[model samples]
Target: MGKTVKLYVHWVDTFNRWVGRFAMRLIFVMAAIMLYAIFSRLFLGRPVNWVMEMSQFLLVSYYLLGGAYSMQLDAHVRMDLFYGRLSAKKRAVTDAFTILFVIFYLGVLAWGGFSSTEYAWSYNQKNYTSWAPPMWPVKAIMTFGIILMLLQAISAFFKDVAIARGRPIA
Candidate 1:
């Protein structure tokens, strides 16, 4: 790989790692909110109106934001039937080929997410709920996360190409 390609990979990997770690912390926040909701409803005899909605928001954030990191770690699910028996180089070749479909899928997803975010921001859209939180923030986050995942997928493709070429990126 060229120096620029290596640099791009390094930078994307580093940024995604940091973002993924940040996303991981959201789980704790979600848990805490759920616990508070449970406690308030049972002991205080008062159900928090926004707790469930907020928890769902946190979950969406966690899943979207952590996607790239999961990809980075190769933690995403795959069919292991024939894949498990392939040699490393063969696996890299397979990954490089398969990731093109993933890249295309993510590209479409990112486009839709960006459009949704723009609409939400422009129209000041709000959820049709009692709490009625603004939708732009979550939509923006979703778009950002999708873009990050797309970048990571590209990076993985590059790495896989290098591996298939017998010059693996370190």
Candidate 2:
């Protein structure tokens, strides 16, 4: 492999690993927020105004940002019936092809999301809610998240290619 490709793979892998670890905390934060909301509503006789909106934001952010991490860990759901039976080389080949499709899909989303995020930032768009939180952050997150996923996909592609060619990836 070229030095540039190896560098990219290393960098993307490192970034995804770090970010994925950080993202695990988001689940706890989301859970805490929900617990607070539940307690406040039941005991205090009023729901938290920002709970729903905050949860939506947290959930989306968690899913989008943590995608690369999930991919790295091979934690994403898949039909394992046939896949599990495949040999290492076959599995690598299959993964490479599927990752190509994922790259294309994420590329499209990232492209559109970038434009939308730019528009939101320029216009200072805000969600139409009682909280009226600015939407640009989430939009930016969506764009950036997809980009990260793409980078991680490239890293995975290289590893799979190595496996397919019977080469040591590391």
Candidate 3:
């Protein structure tokens, strides 16, 4: 309800929205590239060597970047069998508790990812393919994505905690 908290929520939501929009648009690009690769290989009889690697990286980036946005929408999978039966306050409490585990898991992921990205950057690691794309960018994106997911989780946890306490989330 406070101005600061509201501002933060708006900021987070806005960032996720932008990311989601970019990712969605990138899907079209991915499709176009795939079509071109397929057509060129089949018709022109010359396979594009970089196409596979590029597509793989783009797919990874798409999912990683869209994770926080999906979380914001609560689009991630969950077992609805028992969860669906819970009261609102109880569900909120359960969600808050469940997120504790997620926080710990993402903490470890972010730490390891950051270290890996740093090593990649320092060594200038590259893929074994002829394209030999630098690995640091994707690794860095992984770390950044995990951080974004963590922030989204924290926001959700706060909202759930408020709901569990019967507070109106203004």
Candidate number achieving the greatest TM-score relative to the actual structure:
1
Q: Can you list the residue pairs that collide in candidate 2?
A: none
lDDT of 1 at 44: 100
Off by over 4 Å in 1: none
Q: Model 1: per-residue lDDT, tens digit, 1-170?
A: 99999999999999999999999999999999999999999999999999988999999999999999999999999889999999999999999999999999999999999999999999999999999999999999999999999999999999999999999999
Write the residue-wise lDDT of candidate 2 on 1-170 in tens digits: 67888888888989998888887788889999999999999999888889888888888888888999898888888988899899999999999999999989989998999899999999999999898999999898878878989988989999999899898478
**Cα lDDT, model 3, residue 72:** 88
What is each predicted model's overall lDDT from 0 to 1? 0.97, 0.89, 0.85
* C-alpha lDDT of residue 160 in model 1: 100
* Greater-lDDT candidate between 2 and 3: 2
What range of 10 consecutive residues in model 1 has the weakest lDDT sum?
Answer: 47-56
Give the Cα error of residue 11 in candidate 3, in Å. 1.6
lDDT for 54 (candidate 3): 76
Q: Give the CA lDDT, 0 to 100, for residue 164 in model 2.
A: 94
